[model samples]
Target: MQIKRNTALMVGVLLILAVAAWAVTRPAKPRLAAPTAIPVRVVSVAQQDVPRFISGIGSVLSLHSVVIRPQIDGILTQLLVKEGQSVKAGDLLATIDDRSIRASLDQARAQLGESQAQLQVALVNLKRYKALSIDDGVSKQTYDQQQALVNQLKATAQGNQAAIDAAQVQLSYTQIRSPVSGRVGIRNVDEGNFLRMSDTQGLFTVTQLDPIAVEFSLPQQMLPTLQGLIAAPTRATVDAYLGADTDNQTGDLLGEGHLSLIDNQISSTTGTLRAKAEFSNPAHKLWPGQLVTIKVQTALDKNALVVPPTVVQRGLDSHFVYRVSADKVEVVPVQVAYQNSDINIIKGVQAGDVLVSDGQSRLKAGAQVEVLKEPPQVIHTANAQVQP
Candidate 1:
């Protein structure tokens, strides 16, 4: 019994020693620190042609407009043109009853014919009188009187011819014709209505619709830039847009044309300058008094440094962006050249700098960052890793 007890004690002591050795000499397990994932979004920077532009609201107008009226006092016998019909220059638009004027012209012509015949007879008599005077057969007073009668008859014939010409002109005035090539508006007078040359009101209106003009105003600050653009030898083009509202901006391409006119004085109320641009309007999609938005390319900077607009951020007094440097965020201030939709043309952002597109809002001056081995497709948080 004593030997067994001593053997049992020895085994227990050996097991205890083994436990003590494990407690003293076993390799220490490492303590792991939790990882921090910052939420963010990212987009790669690319080089593209950035256009400089000026945007403004404008209204369309007709370059030429005129009121059509009658030139003779007569009844409206026939209407030759319909409302909204396109007419060419000298096209017959309306006709009036010309019976009185025509009868008067016929009477004058008849009188001219009679006067010419009388003048011929007087000339023959004067010739005979001259022959008689040379032979001393007729008295000098009788020859002189015959010559004076011939002169008087010739003058009367000329005056009658003049009256016939004037009467014919008056008869021609009964037909009203289009003075310009344009679209006709509503007709104010119908057939059988008496019209007079002295009528102060117009019978109809015609507007030259094709090749329309779009009038727009630009801020006074844009004058310098516009002058510089105009000074260049090459002519610049402008585009016009029309839509239901400002949001649903639809651009109807009124074909490109030259800048026709610029107002001499600036508007004091709006602090803007008025300008006019002409369009080809081949399809006639543009009309008079149509509202539109104007976009003009002012200039192009060939050497401008540019980046995505999403990377730009506002600083206290200027704009800045966060760039990746040695696995850390570096905020840099940038002077912007201009913004074209999704891209921004800048002066300070370099070509090779890795810009933090989404995490810029959360980044401090220097924050440690790790580029994920597999970039996330969707980043919801502010400090998440952003993919380039």
Candidate 2:
């Protein structure tokens, strides 16, 4: 029994030593620290004149589009204008074979001459018969008959003259002319081809490109604002842009114009109203049927709070911005009044408030931020006079 008790005490002591060693030598549990600040670029909110614009996709249209067709039926003898040639009004386009018309005119003139000669003879005979009847040299009925012959010959000559005039008018139709000043499109018929007045496919087309127009549609809700602009003494300004960016935020400017017209009726099916603007396309950049982006300036705000569009973030319920305050960023909800690719006119943010433009993906509410760079400050100086 004494030996057993000694062995039990030894085992107990070894167990206690193992437990104490484990308690002293085990690795320490790591404690986590707060997240580090994110580096970001920021810009201060600003107050400036912000113009409100309505945007839409539009198509360029020519001021005048006409198909040049022959007015008479004949073989084309002359092709005066080439394809894609710029022409002015009354320019010769083509000429048809006018030989038939000329021949007919000559025939009518010959008939008129013959009739006139016969009428002269009848008048001479009638004068002789009147003198003879006064002296009772021939019957009164015979003199009256001679007078009727003169009248009949006179009527025939007038009819022949009318025919000559008609032939001359028809001859003029053989000379084809451009009714409008424009550029000629593709030619439908070559020289030596026969053309008819009833031909559906015309000789070519003439499209007026300069001072072009753009047609676009806007939502019906904008009708009132558009009406107000139309009622103003001065026309509203419009801008057309080329290809849009990947995000469709903006595009390269193509040209500027003024509002020209608005459709009388709105499209019930599409819930949109059609509008048109005219641009002085001297450079001929805008082509007919080409698609473009259009912006119509409907109104202007003199003093509006604005910020860079990149600083605004879209959330599930509202748009927000990470406003920087003393090295900390807080979530700020903003109401966007208007937005273009460059700037956003917003509410709920004051001027001089700094907002994060980049590195917002790494931020949350109450997160810390490190400003990478400050925006450049502008200094205005008064005009100075130079001394001689």
Candidate 3:
């Protein structure tokens, strides 16, 4: 019994030592630390009126572009206007060889005078024949013959007058004039060159610079929207840029214009509708045949809940935003009503709500957040005031 007690005590001691060793060496139940807030950039939602725009590729076109061609085939005797000269309608651009034309005109005038004198003499004789025929003093055949001579002379005079008018018209063509008010392009045929009516190329081109038109094409789906713009009470505004940036936030703005017209039919192959906008290009910034990007304002959203584009995140099913509650952010699903490069109009958040603008990649639902910087002052419509 003593031996068994000693063995039992030894076994109990060994068990106690093992327990003590484990108590000393094993890790204390890990002390829990509060979750750290994720660092993020945040911005407050703003309420403002925002304009919605649609972009398209466009080409600048002159409203009035004319090719200065010779109406009559003749020698290009004189070039009065220099290249790149601004001219008005009816301004003399050049002169043709008018020697032949003048000669023909002078001959026609002389013929007209001679015919008038002959007609005058025939009329006097007809009067005398009528008086003698009234008493049967002259034969009926003689009186008839005199009257016929008078009629022949009258016809000759009328023919001569028409010839004179034709000559005058031919003479006026010798002085080539600008048909439109515009700037003259580079000349093809110089002075002293023989020009023809059938010449494929003309002397030069005159392109109207001010109040130019821009031709653009949009998808056929936007036809209804464009029609609304055209029928709007106020003219819809448009902007032209250098590159085809659809957001229209980049590149230099070339000119501003108003929506002019939409094409009668859409292009069957491209499935796009052609549209035009007219811009007041007094500075000549918009040139003919230059390719540009166009933005047309389709509508304006009043009191829109605006936020930075980065604030909205695109998820697999729908878009979402991180709405900060206290130190934590909740993923709030949002619908982007209208969006541009700078701002996005969202539907789920209020004007005073704070949103995560950056550092979204490290975020999730109910994630703790640390705002990196204070948001900018929210500029309200009536007065610029910070949102609480």
Candidate 4:
């Protein structure tokens, strides 16, 4: 009986061991099967001859503006211009009281009269002496003395005349005029305020609005391309807009402008070169210190393989994109030429290749995808890129 019981116990222990072995070795419950299709939006990559563009933020500035101030000092008497009023060059903007200056001018005129009378008397005496000396009628010493007196009196009269002219000029300076045709800023000094020549405080400011400058900066890497663009016999042109929201609201298309200036040195910290373009602000839409966006072509890549910007994807170290293939979504490595909001100019992608555009966040290598029936509109190309 004992032997039979021990045999049964041994069999039960062997059975338990076999079951544990099977549990450990069994394949993970066959992973829940993948869905039959993945919903996605796709775009057909095309080599739409895209003009290369470099983009940067810039500030609008008036072509010529300066703070108007008095060159000569006096009590501020009249402010001739109102704030925000348009003024033309040489227009009187303000005036200082010139009562004292007028008096000084009169005094100089009196001095000039006195010197002239003295000169006339000396001339008469010199003439008389010259007549007397002609036939040894007067001593040589007397004639020489009379001639010297005449010359001295003449010099005194000229000096007095110069003083009078200087006084008149000072009186004219009491009326300050606009140096440029532009809108006038707020007036700092009112009537009865004392002004001084040494004071640098501005009485008002004038800024030209019809034509303006848009200042921007580009990376140093673009220098070679910019040089190439410049070397082309036909200079490129660029357009500047005022309103950031809509191109239409910005005003009559500010006329096209050309590359005006480039900085000699690159910024140490940012590695960028400053640049400027002059655009006609016909409607006065561009203003001083207004922030703006600019699109400029630093270089153009001929026959570049381009794709929609939305198709480009950020992977680990390199930028990759999803190329729709027969079997599944295939990850493609691409070299980017440039990127804008709607499209990207790239080097690796080719024409007619279907690229995954909308659904990429959850995509992985070899992930199956389905293209939505709706297609996106393409941005048509026209107008050669101008250097502005």
Q: Which candidate is the best by lDDT?
A: 3
Give the alpha carbon lDDT tens digit for every residue of 1-31 in model 1. 9999999999999999999999999999988
Candidate 1, run of 10 with poorest lDDT: 379-388
The digit string of per-residue lDDT tens for model 2 on 39-127 reads 98888888877666777889999999999888789999999988889999899888899999999999999999999999999999999
What C-alpha lDDT does candidate 2 achieve relative to the native structure? 0.86
Give the per-residue lDDT of model 3 (tens digit) for 126-196: 89988989999899999999989988988999999999999999999999888889999998988899999
Model 3 clash pairs are none
- Can you give the lDDT of residue 326 in candidate 2? 97
TM-score of 1: 0.76
List the candidates ranked by TM-score, beginning with the highest: 3, 1, 2, 4
Best by TM-score, which number? 3
Better of 3 and 4 by TM-score: 3
Ranking by lDDT: 3, 2, 4, 1
Candidate 4 lDDT (Cα, 0 to 1): 0.76
Worst 10 residues of 3 by lDDT: 379-388
Point out where model 2 deviates above 4 Å. 1-19, 25-40, 107-162, 245-252, 313-320, 329-333, 340-342, 359-368, 374-388
Better of 2 and 4 by lDDT: 2
